[model samples]
Target chain A: MITIRIPTPLRSMTGGKSEIEGKGASIGELIEQMNADHPGLKDRLCDEQGEIRRFINVYLNEEDIRFLTGKDTPVKDGDEVSIVPAIAGGAHD
Target chain B: MFIIPSDIWEDMIDHARGHAPRECCGMLAGTDNRVTRQYRITNILAKLNEAELARFDQPKLSDLKQLAPEERADIAFQMDARELSQAQKDIRQRGIELQAFYHSHTMSPARPSATDITLAMEFEHCRAALNLPQPLHVIVSLEDRDHPVMRAYRIEASRATEVPVRRQ
Candidate 1:
């Protein structure tokens, strides 16, 4: 079982549940399985090209999956995945 | 140029002042580069965890001492994700569009900085791909505290153009 943490923005689609448990071999399959159960989530998480939205960051046990293997990143029992919105914009001066 | 009524403009400035020393942000709904209404969203960066964030019924106190000196020193804005999503829905239900993004510059000038340009570019990228209208960036600078300066701009991938602000 994989524990996926949902960001606050998409909490409404998840019925206000912050975390969900699902089973999948990879991150991609987990997203698919979750979307199958809860609609409108995949669209917000992935773009039309099936890529993660630019502002959304997925972390596997504190490691960014994007810098590692992206959607193909493996998942296993007791693994924790966090979806965080990027904190951008500041005084670059 | 964006058109904002004197009352609405004053309200935004008041919001900026209320959160002085720490940047504040809110959403504006309207059409055609003119603002009709505004919704203030809680800035969540001051919190340290999601559980603390979930307790929205409680008031949030942004104690500068809680953050590192550097983070406290910088003028940045981060809206609570849930509040932002709800505000979007509210705008849609009102039959209006999110015409502008508003934030404050606590100690700096009323100008879009490099970081603002980058974030605006990302938003423009998504909007352009979806064929949506780009929203104006409204910055309220409280450098003088008593005499706040508010300005508007259109930010693209490379440059930011100042848009004239006028009373409606």
Candidate 2:
């Protein structure tokens, strides 16, 4: 089982559960399993073309998936996945 | 007057353009309206190789790209301090504050991306630590040459608001 950590902005989709467990041997399967349990989240995280949203970032055990093996990257049991939304605030000159 | 000089704008444009294909990170410093300092904070390209991009998981990518909130704050603070130190040393120097931070989006729009927003929120704490009256966050879109736009925002009352700047 892989652990998925949801960000605060998307918590409503997960029933307010920050972390979830999924059964998958790879990252892609894990996301599929998560979508099966929590519908509507896949749309938010992936584009219509099935690509990960450019703005949203996914991390597996502190390593960025983009720099690793992408969605096909294999995941071992007990791996932790975190979803972080990019939000902006503050002043500029 | 928060007016950006044309030369500085040119420099910023060049810097943003140079870091295309991935993303560029940098700092902006100035007193009042005249910018006197700029520094590159990070280059995401350095962290990613061609092999990693082909086979990484989204979660792993997110985690690797994740700049810790505190670490970001520290970078801003350190940049601010360096600017302050230089300001103090310049007898003719005007009291320049670390006015804003500048970063670029290679394939994204000039408007703040989700990551930009998150980083801006983190930067607010750094600005507060320096007692800055205003903290500015700037995002540069390098996707188009003719339509490049820079957006500025401020965190006030725990919310982000647009702050207007006269384009040079």
Best by DockQ: 1
**In model 1, which regions exceed 4 Å deviation?**
A1-88, B48-74, B128-131
Docking level of model 1: incorrect
Instruction: Give the lDDT of residue B90 in candidate 2.
Output: 44
Q: Model 2, range A14-85, lDDT digits (tens) per residue?
A: 898767888888888888888898997787777667766654556677555766787888999888887653
Report the lDDT of model 2 for residue B25: 51
Chain A vs. native, model 1, TM-score: 0.91
Query: Which number leads on TM-score?
Result: 1
lDDT of all predictions:
0.71, 0.56
lDDT string for model 2 (B1-168, tens) is 455667777777787677554345555667764566665554333322333222223433344345443322211111222232233234124455566667665555655544445555543433332344464766676657667777666655456577776655
Q: Which ten residues in a row have the lowest lDDT in candidate 1 chain B?
A: B52-61
RMSD in angstroms, all models?
12.4, 13.9
